[model samples]
Target chain A: MMDDIKELIEEGKFYFLNQKYNEALQYLNKALEKDPANIEVLYTIGIIYESINNPDKALEYFKKVIKIDPQHEDAIIHIHSISENQ
Target chain B: MERFVVIGLGRFGQSVAINLAKLNKNVIAIDKDPQKVEEIADFVFQAAACDATDEKNLRDLGLKNADVGVVSVGEDISSSILITLTLKEMGVKKIISKALSQVQGKVLIKVGADRVIYPERDMGERLAKRLSSPQLFDLIELTESHGILELLAPESFVGKRLDQLELRKKYDVTVIAVKRNVPKLKDDGSTSFKESMILSPGPDFEILLGDIMIILGKSKGLDKIKKVK
Candidate 1:
């Protein structure tokens, strides 16, 4: 199960680099389903949402990252931005 | 000399022409009302009273070669777009039309306005920010995320050099420039001064009395910067 998720994550990275946001999102979601605690997967989900102008959902994921890792500096700033813009 | 032909003579039109004129640019002020035309005569290179929606009148006034033609007749959306289309078709290089609503603005852009202005709405948004913020006085919103604004420095910066503040790390902002509203010392043997500005200032500068600084930051970053104050 872990091996499958790893291969999917690598494929997601390739799609993200190629600007295939939907494909990247598909694999990212699969990785999250396998290991929901993965910080990089959660952060990537937030970035994908933000790229499409969905700040509320992005904020949600960023908050989750903060809950899992309190010292996450980017999560702190991203939350600050989302709140201020709102 | 490039010329700006501002049509309508309404508040927005007048403001744009006056600001540009203050910048020492050539302005051709126009209005359908003779009184408005007379009011701005001295400030403009030329002032005239003419119906801007009328293509023949605009052509006769040599507005086609104008560097910009702003149609500010938002009271009547149809007239605004008509003037914009006329200006575009008449070979005016740039066309800015004022619109009362988003729908009106879209129509003007579709009809060939290079840009659109919403005076009442834009002012309302600006004033709303001022009303909500305890510290922010004026803002120039560049995007949803970015803005350059005039703000009072937080107490933390009362007597410190700008470099020490480290706004980028502390608050995620960049202080592009500092403005100190110090009084200018006149050519007198006595000690007296008049309120003035120093612009594009540097890190060596220290914040002082009556200073209204210009700051740049993300929208959220500014809130943190101000909140710390």
Candidate 2:
């Protein structure tokens, strides 16, 4: 199951790098379902949402990451920036 | 290139001179105060300490050949009027003057000023508008009842295609452009963002969160959009 989740994450990152946001979201959502507490998956999804101008969804994901791990530096910074702009 | 002569090196005059020079326009700034003239010497094509009210001094400076004249003697109504008359008599085609009040503005206009601006009052109005409507980013009045404005896309607009919104039929406003921050993938596999503008987006375009929409419409329609949550 761990190896499968890793593969899904890899596919998601590949699509994300190619700017195929919908395809990236599909793979990332699958990985998220398999491991709901995965910090990397959650953070990447947050970034995808933010890049697509969906601050509300991005904030949701970032906040979830922060709730799971308060020490998440990138997520914390993203939250502050999004809040400031809004 | 059009030559601009700006008289009086007050705050308003200095800003006008500096901005004109920045735009690659030929600007000659003149002021009675030598210190003010020295301060803006580097920014403009020419900076001279001379009494603009004296027709002889203005003629000596070759101001008669200037395409435009800006008389920005802030708060000194007499100086503004004098300079406006002098510039008009100098055969400057266009004269713009700064006035402290409507009465002064009227006098300047009668004294041959082509345009009179009240910067302080206009600035105060802009601040009040921004404070009242936080969603509005910027606004430019195209006419008395029409305006072009940049505003944050409202919550209800997210994820909906432009055709579905029917903004023209409903709000009577047109979205002329959309400004967005697009995400970019770096070589090192990190994500960054860059600002992009889509002018006259098609009907299939979808509204995204955090997008700033530049819309043009009548004031009534704009006010309605501003109230959107």
TM-score of each: 0.59, 0.66
TM-score of 1: 0.59
Interface RMSD of 1: 23.8
Best by lDDT: 2
lDDT for model 2, please.
0.89
Q: What lDDT does candidate 2 reach at residue B16?
A: 95
Residue-by-residue lDDT tens digits, candidate 2, B1-229: 8999999888889999999999999999999999999999999999999888788999999888899999997777898898899889889999999988999999999999999999999888877876677678888899999999898889899788999999999989999999987766667665556789999999999987668899999999998988898
DockQ-based class of model 1: incorrect
User: Candidate 1 vs. truth: CA RMSD?
Assistant: 21.1
Candidate 2 per-residue lDDT, tens place, A43-81, comes to 889998887667779999999999999998889999999
Candidate closest to the true structure, highest TM-score: 2
Q: What value does the TM-score of chain B take for model 1?
A: 0.77
Top candidate, metric DockQ: 2
Lowest lDDT sum, 10 consecutive residues, model 2 chain B, at B183-192
Model 1 has a DockQ score of: 0.01
